[model samples]
Target: MLDAPSSSPRLALVSEDPLARGALARALSDQAEAWTVVAAGTQEELEAARGEPPDVVLWDTGLRLEEGAAPDLGAPVLALVADEAAGELALGAGARGLLFRDVAPGMLGAALHAVARGLTVFEPGLSHVRAAPRSTAPSGAPGPDTLTPREREVLGLLAEGLSNKAIADRLAISEHTAKFHVNAVLAKLGVQRRTEAVVRAARMGLVTL
Candidate 1:
């Protein structure tokens, strides 16, 4: 992968479907002046590659949103979803921007740049799918103070889509210990899965996707 210059915002293109990922990469190929596709792969592959995180992650959520599906790539995410429900789920999962899968190449480029600049972008038609209100925590959710400092660190790692072994390496702890901390974070966040915990934390303002 080519390293993007500071003047060129780096982008990571992620999609579970290889064909979709290839098509998007091709679409981005001509936009080198605006941004660079520094990485392209499934989330797991990207995580395993361990490259520098991109400025924005363009994730294609095909056809529908899967249960507990979320992209936590340690950068702002611009999700390409199929419909309103998928768009809403993307926002709830901490995606900073959303667009329909059939977005024009030009519009897609604009959305990527907007998201990289810390602006939320959404297809005008899907404007109704907004982030959850920050004023109120999810019902029955614990306060932010519930997580210990170490657990908070683990939570941050989880948001980055790190595996337990990767988290252990980063924190200099045993994999078993990392797993323990991960479980603790999920429990404290009142979530049964890592994706759910990340979504809950983002909604709660505990972590900025």
Candidate 2:
């Protein structure tokens, strides 16, 4: 266990395999900024070590949902699964987010932050999994189904936490054009921030994280 400043959001990494848990913790620690990696172990050990609930719990489910049950970690849980079936199972088990085991460290960090803030996250691979029905879009706002193909592409990049320049490079378009598409996606989703748009898109089954 490592001590982190109280101001930094605390993340608990839970996995059944010690080797896998250590590797994930190290990766997360390497990219940590807004949050800190606190402990890696079972939920009970994490709670006992900190003597308080973490802001978020990143549970690495490996190839299966252990014992076919999601633990109540006394905090939001972001599940790291191996495949879409396990991802769906984790969601059904009440996990706030479902990411694949091969997720990049940066994307995993973003999902942890999002889930900690009470937003649901899904891996792009799980886009085919239909999410539960959500409330209709805001009045005068275009639904997710109405986003243009390019705008939808921008939305997916946003879900990956890409900046305007990064998106431009990825799409081989002008930065200004990428910015324009980002704004369009935000407006259509009726959200002001990239994270919000990602959340809305995921809930609408338009895009995943």
Candidate 3:
């Protein structure tokens, strides 16, 4: 399917588990017919399947790479991880997007297509790992030190693992406004994902988790 140029984008699914590799391939073929899907059960199969390279590589967390360096493959990568911490590791390994292992089929297809189009996505509900270093605000740490009172509230709610809708209901704010506050909190905390913001808050002694 990857041999020639065509309208549909080519994608490679890499996983050690035969079931996972098969399921993802079936989902892409069934839900995302616009994509030409290929499956690889091992690294050797993955390398062999890459004749000209596909538009994207959806790889399982089992794959590892040195920090700050990407896979030699020319295509962008979307990693499947067990949790947000694993997701962060994958990103550091140069994956452009992350999908949790239990993601729904529709989301899996959509995430793949979006990453193929050059977007970096982290699945909702997967936040930063708490094992990150603690923050030391010596009367001044520009990033986490700058969160406003409202943003701090949002961060607290985020730490509670509340979705935007739940946060809005609790605070009696519109969902759009809740989303805005959440994004603002993330920006001030210097974290990319919601869970990361919560972790940062805990590290900074800003939230009692």
Instruction: Tell me, by lDDT, which candidate is best.
Output: 1
lDDT of 1 by residue, 1-209 (tens): 23334687888998879999989988877664666788888866786786887889999988856433345667899999999888877776678899999998888888888887788887998887865422222467588887777888989999999999999899886564587678778877777999999999999888989
Among the numbered candidates, top TM-score falls to 1
Of 2 and 3, the candidate ahead on TM-score is 2
Where does candidate 1 stray beyond 4 Å? Answer: 1-6, 32-34, 131-209
Q: What tens-digit string does per-residue lDDT give for candidate 2 at 1-209? A: 12333587887788778899889877876875765666678644664465467798899887655223454557899988888777777776568888889899988888887888888888888767643332233567567667776788888888889999999899886564576678767877888988898998888888765
Range of the 10 consecutive residues with the lowest summed lDDT in candidate 3: 129-138
Give the TM-score (vs. native) of candidate 3: 0.52
Instruction: Rank candidates by TM-score, best first.
Output: 1, 2, 3
Q: The CA-based lDDT of model 1 is what?
A: 0.80
Predictions ranked by lDDT, top down? 1, 2, 3
| Model 1, residue 9: C-alpha shift (Å) | 1.8
Candidate models: Cα lDDT each:
0.80, 0.75, 0.69
What's the C-alpha lDDT at position 109 in model 3? Answer: 72
Cα lDDT tens digits, model 3, 1-209, are 12323577787776667887887777777763566764465544665455667788888765432122233356888888777666666676568887788788888777777787777777777544322232233444545557666677888899899999999899886564577678767766667999887777888888888
RMSD, each candidate, Å? 11.2, 17.6, 14.7
